[model samples]
Target: MPTSLCGTWDMISNVNFEGYMRALGISACLRKIALKLKLRKVIEQQGDQYLVKTLSTFKNYTISFKIDQEFGEFTKGLDNRHIKSTVTWQGSKLTCEQTGEKKSRGWAHWVEDDKLHLELYCEGEVCKQVFKRNE
Candidate 1:
């Protein structure tokens, strides 16, 4: 296996995020605010559970669960919706499937070339984000 995906990562690039936000039904004003904020991902693992936090100056969101176990998730600061989320390892990629009001919603995280890569998708829209490990 590659290095553990447990560390602090600061985003260096974000692409097509606006389209993804629009797919999530986020308001234009909120999308604009979200677009301006730099995002950070803090990943941790304890025993059989994993915690992934999306952090920003304005807001933070966290989700914790064990692989293959389905759980309920509330996107409190983002889209403000309840969803069923399940995370599983597909090869080196840790992927999540979110079943909610939106169609084709999910995200994947993996390490490539020593950098962290994230892909967020909703309703046929995809947002790709890349982050470097925080030193």
Candidate 2:
């Protein structure tokens, strides 16, 4: 069985997020707002399918995908780009690879100890976000 990543996680620390946003060509105005906002990531998983939502006061982003399946991903409200994306399990980590204008774009999610960890990468910049499970 796959390791469970099916719980609500509250963001505790975000490192290098600005660098990641800059690499994605996010406008300065939007980045300012995003940097200050608190975020909650809610994940629901059933077998191979998953629904993940990133909620914030400024904007919310959601995506649904199944393991090993390629899907068209439209990142609306967040980078406003369309990309072909796929998610697969690499050991205990869930990894997503996005193909589009950006090179080497992807994110990996895993659980460490009692914390949920995310590494969001675009181009060469990587943003690390640590979250604690929400009760």
Candidate 3:
């Protein structure tokens, strides 16, 4: 049987996000706020469809997409830019690619040891985050 990733996950730790924002050319002031943000991710997955929301006091981002389908995405509140986003599954892991002005911008999602792992990347920096499944 395949692993099921359907649940709410609360952010527990963020690693190397400062450099990730810096690589994305985020302003210093905004980077400071973004770095300190207590981000919460609520993910609803049914088969190959997904609705993921990233919430925070400073900004919120939501994405709705299907596996293996490429769609246009506008990053509202954060960056406020548009990009072509595509998500796919490599085994049980979910990988995404966002093609836009920024180089090598994308994210990946997977489960490890009952924890949700997210890796957000842009430019040359990668931000790793771990979240625990909310009961």
TM-score order of candidates, top first: 1, 2, 3
Q: Model 1: per-residue lDDT, tens digit, 1-135?
A: 645899999999999999999999999999999999999999999999999999999999999999999999999999999999999999999999999889999999999998999999999999999999999
Model 3 C-alpha lDDT per residue in residues 37-114, reported as the tens digit of each score: 888889897766799999888778899999889999988777778899999888878889999999999998999899
Where in model 1 is the C-alpha error above 4 Å?
none
TM-score of decoy 3? 0.93
Question: Any residue pairs clashing in model 2, and if so which?
Answer: none
Q: Choose the strongest candidate by lDDT.
A: 1
- lDDT for model 1, please: 0.95
In order, candidate lDDTs are 0.95, 0.93, 0.88
True-vs-predicted CA distance for residue 91, candidate 2, Å: 0.7
Give the CA lDDT, 0 to 100, for residue 32 in model 1.
95
Candidate 3 achieves a global lDDT of 0.88
Q: Is candidate 1 or candidate 3 better by lDDT?
A: 1
Candidate 3: segments with Cα more than 4 A from true spot: none
